[model samples]
Target: MSNNVVPAIINLDVKGPVISRHLYGHFAEHLGRCIYGGFYVGEDSDLPNEGGIRLDVVEALRALDIPNLRWPGGCFADEYHWMDGIGPKDERPAMVNTHWGNVEENNHFGTHEFMALCELLGADPYVSGNVGSGTVREMSDWVEYLTREGDSPMVRLRKANGREEPWRVPFWGLGNEAWGCGGNMTAQQYAAEARRFGTYCRDHGDNKLYRVAAGANSFDLAWTETLMKQLGELGCAYRPTGYMQALSVHYYTVSGPWRDKGDATVFGTDDYYRTMLQAARVDELLTGHSNVMDCYDPGKNVGLVLDEWGTWWNVEPGTNPGFLYQQNTLRDALVASLHFDVFHRHADRLVMANIAQTVNVLQAMILTDPDSGALVLTPTYHVFEMNKGHQDAASLRVDLPSGVPTREVESKELATVSVSASRKDGRVLVSLSNLDAGQAADVELDLRGGAVTGVSARILTAGELQTHNTPDAPDAVAPRAHDQVTATASGLRVHLPAHSFVTVEAALA
Candidate 1:
């Protein structure tokens, strides 16, 4: 298929706001490969590991520069007793993971191991505490253990466990999934619990904790508004350096209803358009949720942490359905790129967003084979690597013209591309993705009346729709560099292939 070339213009002067690093954050639940096989393979593996942390996965994530990681649980957070997983692996009591398959969860990867992994990757940690099944003292003591500077009860306990120095744990989640798996509480009930726990979650004075209240599952703006109204509003906390900072939101793109989520990669082009529609809604969700936040805090000091966002599908065959282990394809990569552009578009409001899991779980970056110890980087990882330019830079929004819209009997969707540009010191970077799958829509970039020079591009795509990586062939869907970018007097003309994802960067003359 040939892309219709159109005259485009891009302005170097008109830029948007700066990008936030939390937008590039990740998640790791204590389920499946995410803990045991995905990132932690034990220090004694023949496949090569550092103190049980997979070296290759660490290197790949470090390359993308993962900003923060949420750990220990999803639903598991609600049932978890932090003490059970801390002191010793063998002596630790055996507990069944009520959330993921009711599997026996050996407390091997505990507090120290998780903190050590964060240290290895040079990333921050967001610890999710239990509200449904734990007490306020339990939550506060956990905080004291990680953040206290001098000798205290929790600090002495930390020292007893071997880590004398305080770990810099900045983000703390009050709870996880309050409505359903967490505990079927109405907004009022959860607010009472939140106030009880959040009030006692005192600061230890060394590593400042930005406490995040357990969030509503999705785009229920009313829940957010009520959360602030019922509990002490986030920004109004007494200390300027707070124990409470932001509210979180979790949403997933599962097409064709919740039960039958079509196929992960076998969808038709129409399905691709529908999937992108749901994925692109992250932009709208942020706008709505932030509007609610602005009402309580006009300065917008309160942030929105999208702690969970990604594609969800039935588990891969032979894997436990409860585990959420699924495949990642080129189609998923396109969806991910679109989501990144959305985050950059709303950088000020969206403080952070973490995909469901980092590896071996839904929409993960890296996957590991249990028996063979083989690992593969997913298409989502490639999308993240390409967009690394926007990690910590300011976002600049350009005037984007309307493109052909994709309409269906069930869903109404638009296909126009959204792009965010940023300049750090001297170099200007623009990250863009084409959501149009049926046809390649040419974007006439207005280069602000300057002649273009020194252009380059990199793209990741595959010919077959179902193409992916496996134990034997891990590089089947890796990114390929593209040099087909062209510069013009008016602007630049870059071809975006149909049903493919690409990122372009250039030096202005």
Candidate 2:
């Protein structure tokens, strides 16, 4: 065991906000290989698959207990027309994915395909409707096609396309990034459009819809305020109707400008520090946005959904620039953990979040090579796997004093330790991260509100900050049993390695 330092005492209280499992949600889009090569490899491919979906990817995602998956598009959602993707695959209309890759979208993987994927993963489907290019009637018909059980033209169309029974999609995004690619409309304009589209997005028999309006982009507080104020003006009666249930926001951790987001793997200590600083800013963004939400929604009736978030680095060498594909690293994992910690602490207002693209896109969880049939789980995937225990667990309040500290790019003091605690199934799980690059931390955990009987821990770390897994070295950075945790007379003590993430599960007495 490493030498013990000044321990950071963490006192956790059992009663707190209940962490929503949807906070561990994911997002998938029609960009690059995210759909075709990453998740679905074709039924005829030589690679092992379950009904055209990659078995390896499916198993990996299922292990994380992915609660929900936002689909169709990020920017692609606004431009997409659902009718083109249904019916016979060969006869379906082909269109150019102008928002992502300028390549042809063959329409092979459409609404049915996404729902089928969701079924296999046991995840709820959150479909983003096309409001920029498609009409309100088109959006209404799409929802009806998926959820309506009674006789309807859309339902009949779905049946003709092969599905006998309708699928249940509880979450519906009114539009995506309406302030930009979604239509470049003003906040007031988008609010009116959202209301119009949401009004017609009727709930099918027994199928309730959680309508989410497209929120601000990053620190655009005015956009959030304008939308919420407009929705709030609609009065209480409209709340139960098709009004906004949540507002969606998008934020990405980019080290540099949009054109040059820096390299994913080749970076120095400064880049690492800066990237983490940006990741930590999510807390600030959420706090500021939630403050605005409280003004119009003092009751906190509507939730804030972080629908698109993750690190956006430079595209891989030789890949199409528009694809937004970047390799995942330990830095990405740290970013994910930081975000999870923030989401857990603010579970009251932040109900759901989706980490950008799940596979083969920006900060992807899994990377696949179609040529070699190589499937490797990224560091971000392990972070998700380790924290899966916190799903649906009641958030535990942890009071952690500043420990060993590191200075970020702006020379601001940052605690080397970050943590969040939750309880479920009579077990208390505490997730801790040691952010220092070269110093291990001995943390004294003060457990309150319960007696601890047993403790077991698992940690994911690497010898080098830039260490990552390739197909050839898939096990380079994976989780291993951490045996340094012990129940102290006062509470519990844990030894956290440098540049590592550890999850401690304690049996409560």
Candidate 3:
């Protein structure tokens, strides 16, 4: 390892908010192969499946302890009509997916299929409702169909469709991207629409909804301010009469222009640093929104939900442009690590965050091959598995030295090292990332408030930043036991390899 060392302090005595497991949530949109071929294959297919859902896919995601899954759409949410997706699969209507690839959607994986998926993964479902072209009664009926019982019309329809009892759906999105893909409505227009739509999404006997309103588009404080003013209150122990429980925001780390996101597996050092710079900006995004939210709901009654995030790279070459299929690389894993560090810092108000699309989509954890029944866990998948220990753990403050190393790209300084710590059960897990492409970081963690007894680590890295897994070489970038950690009475020392993400699990005495 190089002589350069990064010093940081982990104050175990001062604990912050419990890192919500929902912070590790995932999204499964109906875009591209994300639904049909990625997560679902026909029940009659040769591959291992349970009720038309793929078993291999569920088995892989279960390792991450997936907390919650947002479904049905990104932009597709607005155009999705719940009625078309219920009852018999063959009888269900098919619509052209105008937001995604303009391809026909069979509505095969409707509410019941989604609920079955949640059960398979042991995750809660976050259903996003339509606000663009659907009626208020339609959204109300869909909620009732999924959660209500006791002789209602929706309950009758649900029973007719074969679900004898209602399923619990905790998270509900009123609308998605109302300013753009949802309906092209202004901030005021969407806020009014959200208030009206949120009204009828009633709670069932035992299933309470965490209603999330359509919030801003990346750092648009005006939109957030509008929602806060119209729907949120200045100070209240309880939610205002018509206030939504949470607000949703969207931000993607795209290295290039939106129309032409750079290649996923073909980026140089400069491109890597630029991408990290963009990912690091998520802190600013959260701070800006939090400030606006704090002004309206001082007690933090309204939660902030970063429901859509992750890298948005260009689709792999020779693929359908609208499918959003991309390769997940070591660079993508670093972006995820950096985002988690930021999420940990803002865990108090940030309730939940879901990566863009899960399998076979942009920055997906698992990529499935359509031709052959094969699966590959991306580098990002390993990161999630390694950091799963932090879920629902008490956050510890990581105080960094003033001279922490950084790389300047295009007049912007990107921190070369990132760290976050949390305590769960009797163990403390410290996640460290060395972002430098050429230099390894010798990190000295000052462990306070508890005596360190032992330390073990595992690392995920590749020979190149663009190195990724395919069906042929699935374990090319998987995590392996690392041996570069030492623990003493006062602290722990770790050698983090360049372009790598590591987790040091320590026993605190």
Best by TM-score: 3
What TM-score does each of the candidates earn? 0.94, 0.96, 0.98
For model 3, how does the per-residue alpha-carbon lDDT over 1-509 read when each residue is reduced to its tens digit?
A: 77769888888777889999999999999999999998899898899899889998999999999999999878999999988988888899899999788999999989999999999999999999999989999999999999998989999989998999899999999989999999999998998898899988898899989999988899899999898887645665435554378898999999899988899998899899999999999999999999988887878878899999999988999999999999999999999999999999999999999998899889899998888878899999999999999999999989986556888888988898999999988899999999999999989888878776667899999999999998888888999999988764568788988999999997778
What stretches of model 1 exceed 4 Å from their correct place? Answer: 1-11, 231-243, 402-411, 449-453
Tens-digit lDDT string for candidate 1 (252-346): 98777888887776778767667777887777888888887777776667788999989998788788887889999887887788888788777
Error of 2 at 237 (Å): 12
Ranking of all candidate structures by their TM-score, best first:
3, 2, 1
Candidate lDDT values, in order: 0.78, 0.87, 0.90
Residue pairs with backbone overlap in model 3: none
CA lDDT for candidate 3: 0.90
- Report RMSD (Å) for each prediction in the order shown: 2.6, 2.0, 1.3
TM-score of 2: 0.96
Candidate 3 lands at a TM-score of 0.98
Model 2 lowest lDDT segment of ten: 233-242
Please identify which of the two predictions, 1 or 2, would achieve the higher lDDT against the true structure: 2
